[model samples]
Target: MSLHPRRTGWRFQWVTILWLTAVWVLLWGDVSWGNVVNGALLGVLVTTGLRMTPVDFHGRVHPAALAVLLGRFALDLVRASFEVSLVALRPRYTPRGAVICVQLRSHSDLYLTLTAELVSLVPGSIIVEAHRLTGRLYVHVLDVETSGGIEKARQNVLDQEARVLRALGSDAELAEAGLSRSRRAREVAAR
Candidate 1:
């Protein structure tokens, strides 16, 4: 009943072999027939000993969205650095700090991890904790000017999540659905 060949095992074995060969070439930089043979043997041995893990391939992501996210992150880094420098130079002028919670709409663990990493990389904010159950992120911010500070931080997280969703090729309907779910959850929690 199956049209595909039973080649999964062979494919994995070959991957292991290729990986070992590449590693050998990098480590020694000597391209000889002996080295190639040895590397191939080593690869087969190692790959066989190691367990194979399945790869998760979702829909194709847009390269342009990724570029945009990278650019925005770089710009934010520069701007945050300047702000942090000013804060450090004048400690007295630094506003009071507070922690803000951001609820993520995306269900992907990778996206959540990336967003947390990006937020933590900024100058004045740090990710305190991520709730595994709800995908809510708690971030501690260095400067807090007014009551709106928390809301501002929440907005920044949402904006970053939107960019990631776009990069992952999610349609407008999915995006709206995620936003609605997140909003409803927040409201329920508040009540």
Candidate 2:
């Protein structure tokens, strides 16, 4: 009987255990009862021994809004990729990078962090720091002018936060972010 030991991750995650078992079985080249059971035991030991705090998610998902958020993220990714490439290809052009601080409208730290992560995924900008107490994020832009200057970059981060709120925010959460659910979204979710 052999088991694949897994590292500690988030708290009491069932998916982690299942994934560890699957990886163990895959590595062994044959699925057997010993491997499965042993793998689960190892997963349990690791997860229980070292636990991380779980994210607090208090919102019902709006499917349409979620789709919109994902679609926009993809588009932004592609657009940013090209922009970064163009800047790199220009030999004579000197890019000015700047760190811009943005205050998030969302009251929840979850959305604030999520917004930061999403913006970082796009090219030309990365999250430098997130201040949860003040609900602010400091992002470093690769090229300020390429990203349409400081104020525009700041607006982009705020827009990203709005997208996050629209996707997974409750009514109260939306209001707290200074955003209102679209009439269409409200109608669709009502059903």
Candidate 3:
């Protein structure tokens, strides 16, 4: 009857706890002291029971890359909200929705999970399913009327992965994700 979880080289699951707490806070729509305390407690309890086999991560965090990803996410969120609103409100307009399957460049389970969650968090798209073995994401996207639109959506996912890799992926992981350091620098410069 061990009280603590078996060691996984990591002392604490702060990331899981914090992410769960944030979700709890957002779902409750309140950030009061009481709510926060309850959320944190719930986060701890939930994370304790839902332990996963930790995978090796050789990633390094880059503050600039994180900032850029956040900025881009914010802008995309706003734009997508407007687009969805328009599609819903307009009478004559029909959004071309499709289930797009995108093969991820990063085969790591962590990267795939992060990319899927982040993409689904934004409006106008949702990850309907994910194939772990194939590293493919089946996302239902709005306004995907043409083949070009589908390709654009796929590219968007790839770009999102690239941005994430730039922020927190190791050198090997970045290369696996098909984003070279020079390409990353070029992307930043283009922005």
- Winner on lDDT between 2 and 3 is 2
Candidate 3 lDDT tens digits, 1-191: 23345454334567667877888889999889888888889977876777656655679788888898899999989888977887789898877789989999988888889899989998889999999899999999977753248889899988888888888888788766657655567698578
lDDT of 2 at 66: 95
Worst 10 residues of 2 by lDDT: 1-10
Q: If the candidates were sorted by their lDDT against the true structure, best first, what order would they fall in?
A: 2, 3, 1
> Which stretches of model 3 miss by more than 4 angstroms?
1-5, 13-50, 145-148, 182-191
lDDT of 2 at 91: 91
Question: lDDT per residue, candidate 1, 69-113, as tens digits?
Answer: 889999989988987777778846747899889888865666677
**Best-fitting candidate, measured by TM-score?**
2
Query: lDDT for model 3, on a 0 to 1 scale?
Result: 0.81
Judge candidate 1 at residue 32 and give its lDDT: 86
Q: Write the per-residue lDDT of candidate 2 for residues 18-136, one digit (tens) a residue.
A: 88888888888888999999888887776677654555567978999899999999999999999999999999999999999999998687898889899999999999999999999
**Candidate 2: stretches off by over 4 Å:** 1-43, 183-191
Model 3: C-alpha RMSD to truth? 4.8
- In order of appearance, the predictions have TM-scores of 0.63, 0.76, 0.75
Worst ten in a row by lDDT for model 1:
1-10
